[model samples]
Target: MPTSSVVVVSKCSVYPDLKSTVKSLKLSVSDLPMLSCQYIQKGVLLPHPPLSSADLLSLLKLSLSKTLSHFPALAGRLHTDSAGHVHILCNDAGVDFFHAKAPHLSTEALLPPPDRDIPPPFRRFFQFDNTLSFAGHVKPLMAVQVTELGDGVFVGCTVNHAVVDGTSFWNFFNTYAEVAKGVKKISRSPNFCRDTVFNSPAVLVLPEGGPSATFSGDEPLRERILHFSREAIMKLKARANNPTRNPDFCAPEILGKQSNDSWGLNCKINGKITEENGLRKDPTAVISSFQSLSAQLWRSVTRARNLNAGKTTTFRMAVNCRHRLDPRLEPLYFGNAIQSIPTIATAGDLLSKDLSWSADLLHRNVVAHDDATVRRGVKDWESNPRLFPLGNFDGAMITMGSSPRFPMYDNDFGWGRPLAVRSGRANKFDGKISAFPGPEGNGSVDLEVVLAPETMAELENDLEIMQYVS
Candidate 1:
């Protein structure tokens, strides 16, 4: 297929005055020290429109303006203080708005098959220009691109990650949609009080962390989409629940005999095993679909890379701390409220361990991020601000974000729900994975995996992995 070219129809700044209800906002401690670099892009394709391009543009502009009036921080620009702390300058400088068109493309053409790679044209839907650089004094913290396609309209938003995480990003979009749809009251109003996160005056600095230098190579990274159906997920659950054929061989020494007893006991306690003839009953686990899928991908990706068995591999899982913290944050609390829970394991042990073992490990790590841990993390970062050390991907370090719980497919601007939602190419970093709810809304998962070309090739054909993909 020929790549559809996007032409910019209009470019302008959208300055929306903050409503009287909104006060001057600042970046919270959790938001500081983040790379003023990355932008989170979300692309939504709305089918055959009820409104013309001009009408849609006007509606979007008016709605976005009103929405920003409530979310005044988005209309602001990033500024650094004398102590190097980043803050939002709620000056209503404005967000960048681009009106674009892809005359030849259709929503259908852009929605690639499950086994195929997302086309480059699909990514062009997002407007990512000066919105990405926070070093400038007048840079936009958010950018919106509205593209007219043959069959539908594509709305792409790029929000600076330094100011917003996945939750805040979607919250902004959903609110925009609500306004466009003429909803009188938004379901979740944003809470912009930065003081709620921290009261310390010290400038927060992110811990220094990047891809491992030792494993850095020149190989190009590739992105692929992997689909796991509801049925497939069920089978994976079953497989994970089933007792290993060779427990003595597969179980690590750290688990020992107690590991076998625990596995059997869990199944028995959960009624996953029948009293008669020892036939396996319904699968159940303390771990959830997220843990199971994450564990499976981590193990399969490690094997696909053919990494040294003795090498250390880490899985950095992003955990939402909104509810995990004491005096839980409101559902619409804005800014970055995510903490990474890292689980480290030797490649040999990780590869050799049973799926349940890995899932249990992930589950435990996730459960560990309670109120105390989150508070401690905040204090630690406050005392010595530093970015999370994410050493080189080199196939050993993996980072997973986004969540099936996100309402990516639910943002409707009166033209019906989005036919497909996608992430921008900027997320295509090696060993990075994003999880989205399946198109069917049937409790399945669609994973967007980015890996080196060779590793991806191997992953595509791996029998063990393919067994659960369909």
Candidate 2:
């Protein structure tokens, strides 16, 4: 299939001016870390457009403009203050929209056999290959690309990471779908206020131009969009909740037994949470689909790498902090309110522990990051703010991003439910995994896993991980 070329790139402005209403929105500590990240590029693949390319684009452009009215930051510019802090100048400048056509390409190209890697054309589906989130200072804060396929349309959107996180990004996407499908009223109005209930601003001066959001494109990686069926997920969840001790499950030798005094394992138990010596001991202690799946992935990846027992491995998760606060941020609060929590354990411990044991570790660590924890992170950053470390720093780190909770398949621009979800090569590195929900509302999940060539080969052959990989 020949790659698609962006035939046209135009500016799509918001419908009404909002400068008077929102003069300038301040950047929060959470938003600052993303300055080092590239634009968040993700979109859906809808089959068979009912209208022609021109006709469909006109409707989409109009709907997108109206949608931008609700999300001014998407159309605004990033402004830096004298103190070196960043802010959004809500001037309604507009976002970049690109139109493309792949005359020889077919939708089938993107939907390859489950055994093969994602087709290369999916990389050409978006326009922002090198644009960083901080580049919003001079470039459009957002960009959308619509590609006409033989049997489908690829609606790829790239939003400034410094402006919105995954939650707010989907909010704007779904709102556009609503308006495009003829919904007059905005379903979820965005709240762009950066003032939080546990607020503390981290104003750090920049070095040179700003943090470079570059990822070496030269690295060879295997990006697999693995879909886990509801049944497969249930199997993992069952294993995570079961107390049947397997001969292979080994207790940690050096770390000894796990401790339970902090916050009483505020973790999300499958049914009811009961604590025993800092851990859940119930044979029926249920675990969630995400917890089960993530823990399994964490363990399987570690095993595949075949690292030394004493080497430390880390799991970094982007946690939402809105409702976790004491007072709680009001609903629909926009901007980045996420804290990337890094959970650490020795490779030996993760590999030796039972599935439930590792899941419990992930659960308790997340639960422990409550209001005070979030506040302390902010103040610590204020003392010395730094850009996000975007790679596998310790050669044993796995970073989990995007959530199955995000409404990825809800991007039905009146065409129909999406056939699948896809993304571009922006800020991608080895050991980075992104989770998306299955098309049906069942318990199934999809993981977009990126890893080195050798690791991916070993992981694909790992039967334990493959047994539940539907």
Candidate 3:
């Protein structure tokens, strides 16, 4: 509840467009009223030192109550009428607080102790024991726990996926630090209105003669989440980055190896066998792999399976479109400033696609993104007389560069920089992948993959193979 930490870094300059970016996000989703910030709250547990349990709880409740008053967004309440539409409750809901108790079991060597039970608060919120359901009511997105360690308290926090992305979440946490430190006054600000950006979508229609493209499906496919372990990830990253000890090895070298060594590609297809109905070379795709995966994906990729014979599968990469958009909107406009570019080949294709081919295709695609015509093409497609194809793609792999220079880590609230920070959930689509910087500031990144069970196993096997090679 009390924000206090040593300082690591600081940025006094405010991004001029910061407020506009937030305003744009609220506007873009005006149609989805249920997705408001009033319901978006973060849970953090902080350990107390030299304090009694009762005394600690009381102090926390008071601090949290005061902290909520300052956020304005959290202080406000929401209500759903009989119509099922959400309305802002004009009054304060007053932050709620309750004491957490550890379960008890008598020590007995003869019999195994009863299964360790989860605390009530954790159960109601995390439901860590249950399977995740996308359609179910989204529970509390995050919760922070304060545990009393020997010398100090540890603060743990969790957040929901729908309310904020990583950038916005940190922004909120920074604001919290500002509030707890008495640096800023909390006002009953009504900043969550959605009309600011989308308020004028009609004026931003696309231009005619949009770009040509094809779609795997008419709709943007649903996303999936996955998680991978730290050790296994490190091994894959090391191999991907520098497969050969030879100093000359670079992207080209790695790319070539990936294509030529893929399982199906390594095995040649007989020319005569191609004449058979099901013997044609597989048309699968292998896309770019990133440096790391988000925490939520650790489990999914760890359990993925390999692809079935002859089935086509491709990996995808999300390219940031911030700079590629209208130059007039440049200087770094935020809010979904990205689009998915897919590179696919079957599992065999991934192994067989020559690195030069993969690299060339990547180079071409990357260059195409730089041209202004791409935006024009997008506009043309939007305004076309009939539906336009976006692209044919199966899944995605997202790469995020570490911004240690960004104020994200230095967002000090009278406290020191965070030891760890990450997204609450992985991407929402199957074939989704994520990554972030690893410790030690090495060029390597942590990675995660979300694939079907069979595909996941295949990836693991491939990873083992890479380990053996290096």
Who wins the lDDT comparison?
2
Q: Measured by TM-score, how close is model 3 to the native structure?
A: 0.47
Off by over 4 Å in 1: 1-4, 17-23, 129-133, 197-199, 204-219, 241-269, 272-285, 388-393
Q: What would the per-residue lDDT of candidate 2 be over residues 355-461, giving only the tens digit for each residue?
A: 88888888778778899999889888888887777778666989999888787888788979888898899878888999888666454678999998888998998
Please tell me which predicted candidate would have the highest TM-score against the true structure. Answer: 2
Tell me which of candidates 1 and 3 scores higher on TM-score. 1
Which regions of candidate 3 are displaced past 4 Å?
1-26, 29-163, 177-304, 308-310, 316-343, 354-432, 439-444, 448-458, 464-470
- Residue 441 error for model 2, in Å? 2.5
Ranking by TM-score: 2, 1, 3
Ranking under lDDT, best-scoring first?
2, 1, 3
Q: State the lDDT of candidate 3 residue by residue for 1-470, as single tens digits.
A: 11122111211111111112221122122222113212222233222244675565444444455544433333333333354333333234332333333222111211122121112222122111221211112232233343333333333333322233334344555555555445546422323543222222222221242212222223333222122223333333333323443322233323233321121111122212211232324322212223122211221222233334344544344454444544433322222233445444444443444333443444356546653644544454334422211222433232222222123343333344443333322222335444433322222232323344455445445543333221
* Clashing residue pair totals per candidate (backbone < 3 A): 12, 2, 69
> What's the lDDT of the predicted structure labeled candidate 2?
0.77
For residue 99, what is the lDDT in candidate 1? 94
Task: Please report how far candidate 1 places residue 328 from its true position, in Å.
Answer: 0.9
Q: Which TM-score value belongs to model 1? A: 0.86
Q: Give RMSD (Å) of candidate 3 vs. truth.
A: 14.5
Worst 10 residues of 2 by lDDT: 254-263
